[model samples]
Target: MPVVKEAPLLDGSAGRLVRLYTVSGGRTRPTASLDLLTLVVATGSEPPPRSGPEHAQAMGLCRGPISVAEIAAHLGVPVTVAKIVLSDLVDCGAVAARPPDSFDHPTDRSLLEAVLDGLRRQL
Candidate 1:
């Protein structure tokens, strides 16, 4: 297993900022269109030779489909940072991304009720 570097907190600290910058290769924006709800999965392709540790770690987490928000949480990095890393993997064909399903009627009462019922059942 490749060693993944610990993600630094985005606490407005200089050292943390530097590490984050390093992780993203100084790129502030991702080329791929991604959101918190976007689902990413491993494509079973190896990362490029020059890929960073974050790429490897992200790939490991992506053995199954996982949301971008979950990836950020697991990686201990900010959502933006996760997006950057995921975008790179996407560009390299090492990972595949699925946009979140769109709901035609987001305000449907039945949907809300179903969600509430599911939550209640969990509790």
Candidate 2:
């Protein structure tokens, strides 16, 4: 007969989490870690949101990796508006992009080079 022992537990304001470590082959490994991402949830009233034609169009354009300002110009909206829409999409997980860098419109040579490179890759 063998005795069964329980794992140690960690408690939080939201829930209790169990921490378990396993020993094997002279090595110790943590079997589990706290689900910190999903365990703490947000609860509060949110603002009423709106989307214009350009915003909807931008959402589609942003389905693939894209820069925020590029999508803004493509959809004919001001950069500020585009930024808000992009932020909302990111928070909602509808689109994905690197967070904006201090933006400058891509230069002519830069644009042409990127296009050529893309064409080369496809061929």
For model 2 the local lDDT of residue 87 reads 52
TM-score: which candidate is best? 1
lDDT tens digits by residue: candidate 2, 27-72: 2321222111111111222322554344356556654556655665
Write one digit per residue (lDDT tens) for candidate 1, span 33-86: 999989999998888988877777899999999999999998878999999999
As a TM-score, model 1 comes out at 0.72
Query: What's the TM-score of every candidate structure?
Result: 0.72, 0.37
lDDT of each: 0.87, 0.45
- State in Å the error of residue 7, model 1: 12
Please state every model's RMSD to the true fold in angstroms. 5.8, 20.4
Q: Clashing residue pairs, candidate 2? A: none
The reply for model 1, stretches above 4 Å from the true place, is 1-18, 102-123
